[model samples]
Target chain A: MTCATRIAFTLALATTALVAGTLAQSQPPARYGLGRPATGDEIRARDIDVMPDGRGLPPGRGTVAEGAAVYAARCASCHGKDGEGASAERLVGRNEGDSFAFATNPKLVRTVGSYWPYATTLFDYTQRAMPFQRPGTLVPNETYAVVAYLLFQNGIVKEDAVMDQATLPKVVMPAHGRFVVDDRKGGRAIK
Target chain B: MKSSRISRRRALAAGTAGIVGAALPASARQNPDTTKVQGPPGREVGARSPFEKPVRTAFSPARTATFTPLQDLDGIITPSDLHFERHHGGVPAVDPQQYSLLIHGMVERPTIFTLAELKRFPGRSMIRFIECSGNGGRAYRLTTPTAELTPQQTDGLTSTSEWTGVPLATLLREVGASPKARWLLAEGMDAAVMTRSVPIEMANDDALIAYGQNGEALRPEQGYPVRLMLPGVEGNASVKWLRRIEVADQPFMTREETSKYTDPLPDGTARMFSLVMDAKSLITEPSYPDKLEGHGWLEVRGLAWSGRGRITRVEVSTDGGKSWQNATLDEPVLPKCHTRFRLPWQWNGGEAVLMSRATDETGYVQPTTAELMKVRGPNTQYHFNNIRAWQVGADGVVRLAGGAA
Candidate 1:
């Protein structure tokens, strides 16, 4: 090779090495292996979340009649006898008519019947945190019962309706159609 | 001649007496030294002087939140003790020795990490702000006049801190997250067992499993042993007292995300998962409850921040919204961090209205309350980042001024 060509090749190799060294300094190692692999049983113990399409639901069934008894015995103290709200949030009221008008008025209260858009959220919330004082203590059937009774009181379900994993998702909430996904991305436009 | 000489001697004696009297006080004056006796021995840990403390205000019967004294702070970083707190359930006390975080579902290796084990991995730190979406709830109430409201009562639910932790991306790589996993559910150990679904893309970006705040172990009120820190997101998304994470293909639609944080609109439809806090600014000094002494040569100082990126510019309007001028931004304008801005004004002892507007690096301008209300409607509850105005009266009293939007 000519002397000029050899010098150019040497300079290119040095530059490449420098760039590689900088890249290595900026990137983290792929893995550290600091934590232990979790066992299947360990995961199942805490993986109690349920999705919108009826995923992660435990097998159980409950009727409105059964739920009425459960609500009176365990929930009535906090959620009120008729779901009109006592010490806690009101669970039933103002489900029909213009929701926008009701929401604008500060005196008008927001409840499960008037605001919540998804029925599955009721089951998930009740199962995870309900009866306020004793959370995660109710069995899946009891949770289904409470949800069924609440829905029935809201005029969304019949008095004898039963709620289970298969039937719960099918029960359409009154406010189901009133929720829109967020469309705002950061920009000069307000929307 | 004898009488004149006697009068001159008398005058001389009087002058001597006056000089001696002035010297005596100069020699005897040790008031500061007298009061400067040794103070009590220093304690093992230092504390702010008894006179200095951040005022805390609680909301609701359960005292679920303690608002920070934003008007009282001087810099961008909020002292750890003075950080604002909003807890659905009371703070949980978790022992570092017993603390463990579980990562499962949609992963090649489901892993359990102890506090010590997590710290062994590579760590990263960043200064960021966490603001609750419902920060300006009280401002929306039409009954309360703007003059009656204080900055602490309006926007005290936001605070910034320097957090240190293991990068969540590093930990996810260690456990090997599946490509199909698009979201992850983070659950806390608080009594409510608060849970929120986070997008996987955020985790791989700048998320952290934070264990330190302001250079010390996380405060119990902040999160204790560990917490999730998602930069620039709503405060609730960064779950405190974090315990478990479940990788999944879809959002879990937990109660916190569905029933609570969602924003309602005028069209009867609610907006869900509206997580990012928009650009906002607030004038801290010469604000409500502070009366100017003389109203001349006042330095208008305040803070500006954006969840999307760095604050590019801040403009102050002393004549309400009629005119504007750019304010000087403090140095080290970090992204997703609070930037302190200042403007010098000469108050002419006349009635005036003051307001600030923030424009972020993304070119998103902070909207006026009227503009925000047009889009969000009167029913919207969260993410209220609008131009706030404080009026200075001829009597030198500054009051909040902007009617219901």
Candidate 2:
């Protein structure tokens, strides 16, 4: 290798090392095998992801009263009268200390409090892909209210814990401790 | 020693930068072989044309992903109709005229290209296998491996598509990505908003935003309009119904990446983002749910593939993991595509444990569950690519072993 090339590589390595050391927890687009960073318009076109931590949440909130009307109008057919998901899907429920099952029971499948890991996921998932008949139509507040009612059904928060950016991220989940990150490679298998 | 040290350090750095990095060692980077590179076969040479009428099944009417007739298929390219479907909320009906991809993020100029615009660019075709990472979980039990399953259900998780698309690098270059970009978050327009993170270097090299599958418009289930085609990576990373791609400095930690796809290793820590499907093989002809009539002149056949690269060799065992003999691979063992292997077995009505081990061209050999568990520890239920065992009963009944039979 030429001395010039060597120096260029050394600079790249030094830069990469610095980045890898400090930003190891969250590398850029390429680290996770993506190509490049997203542009503002690109992010705007489909930046629907809302973190359980309220990172991508938009500005809005809703009341359980409003949610009842919205649910009946859009979500009731497939999600059932109370978000049970008619033939489409189950919207809530989690029996504590139980693994999630589909055909167990209506009471079992409709408890959002028992199964979902994050409250924000309920909002994000519902907002991004809910109602079945029509998705991505719910306003931010409608999503929050649906999320609030689902939480109340799960016995998680009371009827009053407002489901908004500030309040949603703080709701400690019942099944939060049930998950663990995967750590299983780079060596011989141990019994 | 000083000069040698300099070269070694340089090679390491180059390897780290990867092929898509801004600068590459001129000597190490091979020029793109545009000559042998392919496009959709213009008109089929009398075979089923690229745009043939859909294959029909008189028996059942399950739409979306159809069941491949495993017993009839000679090699690995599943008849397009038979490939499995795992779509969320069913496939969406999209118009090609309305299809366009918007590339934004750390790039100098974000650009949007229509389907026709994407086709105008220099295009290439890849014969790759995109198996769901959880492809072969069924049939650990069953005597007489062939009895494990009917060819359709037993050998359906895998499929090969000769995809045509513009190389991801060409678009990335046009957009002018920044050197600091390390991650790419890919999102699908499906109702679920399936999103995940991909390393940029990988995208810069073998990734393609494929709009065509098997010579036609991308199937809705296969991400019609346009989808991300990441060669040699996990199928999930290749987002179907792709809408937007964002270059970033960190992973988005999408629910699919964090909660669902991750596998738990023997250690308390789980395999957070196991992107590549390890080498795996299954006997297609005489496998479970499939019944063997008699053992006169049995043709031993199976499909073998590796996510890391191409398959170099496959060894078959009539007596389980013991006494492995080489199986002749059908020639043209393309990288990332299913390579068929055949072994003429002379079974004289004896009991046996049937297994196959696939080795990739990268010299990373496929290990048995026993060997894999040695490193990953035990209790790994997901991503199990262990040597499958099929026991043959005296009464000619083949079933899964370990009492699962």
Candidate 3:
């Protein structure tokens, strides 16, 4: 056979194989195409959730002293003067090692010091909804301050430790080591 | 002569009437007034008879929960208005014309769907029960006297209804969810902006964007315009008044998931995102505060359900936990829906402890309060589903057991 003819035949075989592979990878479309596609601006306005790893932490910084002041002015009315709790949930307690020991006890109060596993959760929850009456009103810095103060109250961080996107996630909660990922599938096993 | 005969006949009739009246009880006497005529026709919108109105009892002042009157209901389906409610924020009155659901994040096409546009998709309906994780929390309190407790207060956070809506999978597919998407953050429109992280697999399985309940438009309290319904999971996961769903590769770790619904364990480690409510059942009839009267023949009735699947078996224990007998489950035992169970009991009017245990399709048996505390510890507040014991006294009073006698 001639060399040019042999090369042309090989090229045709390769092209057919490529076309078949493309067809095999395509999935049947189930699109109804009913709603309009959302724009970038529309998504940005409502994508406000923060993760445990601090992936969505906004740029802000606050000290424990600043957080204390913010807590007194806004959070203390509901959470109590010393975070002991009044009308709302208590935010500070000293039951570090014994929090789970008293799990069934109604008097065994849960607080940031004893129960919460992630410090980043404080910043996320407070920024999203706090001050009970007027939620989402606090600025990012104020939210950081409030979180720093709560952590300090729980003896989790130093009073002067600055809480920002970089350091906040690093502040390991005392209860962090205690939590186990949920292993219970629907079954008779207790765990 | 005619006057004398008439008097004798009248006297005989009067004597017969007196004898009959004396033999009958006062309540059994025929009422002349009620037999007069039929009453007026009903109003345009039908109303439950004044004597038959059953209402929910609110536990908290914020109206955080309005418990269903479980004992008063006959079948599995809870009336739209009578269904139990638990809202982080008060129900908002939403105008359907202005409502829309926004789907974004981790998707090839992020879409904004109007209520009308959402309804245009092929819809599905299923009978399912939505139960708060805190349904049986009150039963854990050992201080409250059981005599004062009612079944409604103990296990009323659960209610079953036929929810109608577009499958959430359809919406996610239509929006073209990215291959990396693993979770979706469902956010509500209430003042609290209640948010929950739902696994994407559940959405693909049977989760719904429910817009109708019990053959009518969704009730205002049940998220009138639209709500996300994750059947068999904790009620909180089925966010009400849903406005947006953001697909993500990781869970958002919202406050509800992190702080509130998470269950604490004996090892000091809390269990996060333990979403599926296990097999649980409660005997509604012959429950607390209901007297047995003479206790000859009592038809014991209750509800059994599981988030995993259908209730396979419900066992009734008349002699406490010592012995268990299988109860008859009503027809149409649906998955993630309440299944009614019945049993016949011949009470001898002596002291007894009656309880029920539910086993679901996955063979998961309902744990006792003691067994639950052994693993979860006494401090764990959420997801308390344990076998409830009703202690009957010789006086025919039935009260919940494990509380102040």
DockQ of all predictions against the true structure, Cα-based: 0.53, 0.14, 0.42
The weakest ten consecutive residues by lDDT in model 3 chain A span A96-105
List TM-scores for all candidates, in order.
Answer: 0.89, 0.72, 0.86
Predicted candidate 1 versus true structure: per-residue lDDT over A26-93, tens digit per residue: 88677876889888888888788888888887899888889999999999999899898899889987
| A1-191 per-residue lDDT for model 3 (tens digits) | 59998899998889999899889667534897899988888777776777888887999899999998999999999999999999998899866354565455656667887777788888878877776788889998999998999999988899889999999989888667665667878877855
Between prediction 1 and prediction 2, which has the larger lDDT? 1
- Error in Å for residue B308 of model 3: 0.9
Arrange candidates by lDDT, descending.
3, 1, 2
For candidate 2, write residues A1-191 as lDDT tens digits. 89999999999999999888888656334312223344565657677777656777888887666677777787777767865656655666666455433222323432456545677767777787776657788889889887777777667878766777798889877656545543333222221
Note the clash tally of each candidate. Answer: 0, 78, 7
lDDT of 1 by residue, B183-224 (tens): 999999887788999999999999999999999999998898
Candidate 3: list runs displaced more than 4 Å: A1-29, A96-108, B1-36, B143-146, B403-405
What lDDT tens digits, residue by residue, belong to model 2 across residues B1-83?
01111111221211233333335334324544546645335664455522222232212242534444444467666655555
What overall lDDT, based on C-alpha atoms, would model 3 receive against the true structure?
A: 0.83
TM-score of chain A of each: 0.81, 0.67, 0.78
Better of 2 and 3 by TM-score: 3
Minimal lDDT window, size 10, model 3 chain B: B1-10
How high is the DockQ of candidate 3?
A: 0.42
